[model samples]
Target: MVSKIIALSQGNREYVTDMRRYFHMHPESSLQEFETCKRIQKELTEMGVPFKVVNDIGVIAEIEGAKPGKTVALRGDIDALEITEKTGVPYASTVPGKMHACGHDAHTAMLLGAAKVLWAMKDEFEGTVRLIFQPAEELIAGAKIMIEAGCLEGVDNIFGIHVASAYKVGQVDCTPGPRMASADMMTITVNGVSGHGARPDQCIDAVVITAAIAMNLQTIVSREYSPLDPTVVTIGQMQAGTRANIIANKGTLELSIRSFSPEIRAGLIESIKRVATGTAQALRGTVEFKLTQGTPPTINHEGPTEIARAAAKEIFGEDCLVEREKQTGSEDFAYYSERIPGAMAFIGSAVPGPYVPHHNELFDIDENALPGGMALYVTYALKALAE
Candidate 1:
């Protein structure tokens, strides 16, 4: 089934290439994907497909087939991160301090490709195919907004895919459950008295207090949270002090916490807030805390996972599909699958080159993974609707 879908989509390479480049040239962020939505609307119009725009910036394109079947939704986030364009490639992001480092460009393009394929196969398949061009996924609230906009009103199943670099090209890694982690954010600020450097003993240094709080926050997780569970507490940002001659009057700490189990995440959060509060008191300072709830663990529904696995086998002949370990990273698509029975997958795009980490200044994906993503999108939807 997947082989047939891939062959069909490959035949429309020119249109697919054009869509990829157009999206690459004009990028958008979060709910600000207005022009991007217009472009997608135009494409859908060209195909004579009907779609609804909502959340002031997303799209739900509906294409009906000749027969009756279950409705399946295929989602692609239409947002860009705040990272700058450092790839130096000719098709690199044109917007300053903003680029598609997280492969949302590929996502949008591939979903459009799948829409093209799905539209052409309307006569062979049954039921409706919902193409979701969502926004604010990187913010982690895009799925919820689209849901509020009734994107999944009548959808029976949903499907999403991300461009994966962990494996070599053409590889696909996804398990039946707990595919991605729960992502929540945290922040802490400490206040202290400032004094001249000549009399350091007279001042309660916020910088010193921040260092202690940071170290203890880690202990709160390692000693408090279950060792058997995967919990990550990373302080990605810290700020304190003004000059070397003056004792710091204030300090701030920002972090991202992740886990597969909600129980573990809750426990970690409680311990973190407690430690930050106590640490500040012990250092004769006051503290403030803020934590933002993020996506739940992305679990693949049993029904959809089987369809995806089978489709993958048909496309890559079984050897390319691997049951890999669960990832602590979180994806907003989890928000979508959480509401509807669906599967979120990863397609390998790694190539033989300098491996720059995600969000790094030089990260790049192999263009080869483009077709695989598009193929899987169409194959999974067709297989599920047929069932």
Candidate 2:
């Protein structure tokens, strides 16, 4: 079975790479993947796979086996980052201010390749394979939208793969348990009396209060949370006075909080509110703290993870598997995994050059890695359904 899957994936390598390049040349942002969705549907149609569109953007396709059994799902995010292309490849993105910097193009292609393979082997397996071509993953809202639209209604176990440019082309990371962090957005607004800059004590100086609040917020991580716990509180955006001479009355800070533990994540949120409020109050100013909860930490289930490991070992080799530390980076795939037994693997796509991280303009993956990822998806669904 493994050999057949490998051969099938290899045979479809050019088709997969061609589709990936097409998506790369015409990249789209989150929730706005109309052309990409249409193209995906076209490819699915060409392959004779039945599919339905969900949330008006996501594509859900199914391949039922000759016999009835449990159903397994495979997801591929189809959104691109809002970054301009700099890779200089002949297939570089033509869309200005948007590029497949996060390797979603490759993901979409690999999943489509998997879909082709599974459809061809539907008679061999005894269950169903659900192929999810999701959009708006960059906004971390697509998975939830798909779930609400019933993408996981009949799924027994789910599996996803992400391309990583940090490791060599054949490596795979299938480590179970908390592979990615949860991400939540925080906003703190400080209000004070606006007065002339020359005034001595008339103005409350919201800018000063905001700066103080930002500094105090750091204590929530450094002083409140345990050093052993992985947490990050980053103030990515700050706004204050419009001019140097004028005393600003309004100041705002936008932050991104990341953590692996739910308890610590909750605690950090409370601590942030307390610190911001207390700091503003002490400075004789008022503050408004708002938090928008985002995706939960991607926790890989033990059973599905074992299936993924076994699949990787069979399709690739034992030496292809590698250990990687949990990352603070978050993935919306957590939404699906949270509801069912699911595992997400990292497929290495590093090219011969300096490593470039995701969300960067110059980020890219070696096309040679596409066949391995395609095979992993096919093998995982087969093994998982047999269980």
Tell me, by TM-score, which candidate is best. Answer: 2
TM-score between model 1 and native: 0.86
lDDT of 1 by residue, 245-301 (tens): 999989999999988876777887888888988998998988888888899888898
- Candidate 1 error regions (>4 Å): 1-3, 83-90, 94-97, 190-212, 238-251, 280-287, 360-363
lDDT by residue for model 2 over 1-387, one digit each (tens)? 999999999999999999999999999999999999999999999999999998667899999999999999999999998998898999999999999999999999999999999989999989899999999999999998898878899899999999998889888999988999999998888999888889938989999999999888878888887888889999999999888778899999999999997788898898898899899999899999789999899999999999999999987798889988999989999999989999999989988888798889999889999999999999999999999
- The per-residue C-alpha lDDT of model 2 at residue 369 equals 94
Predictions in order: lDDT: 0.83, 0.93
Query: For model 2, what is the error of residue 128's alpha carbon versus the real structure, in angstroms, after optimal superposition?
Result: 1.1
Q: What ranges in model 2 sit over 4 Å off?
A: 196-203, 241-248
TM-score of 2: 0.94
- Predictions: Cα RMSD each: 3.2, 1.9
Candidate 1, poorest ten consecutive residues by summed lDDT: 354-363
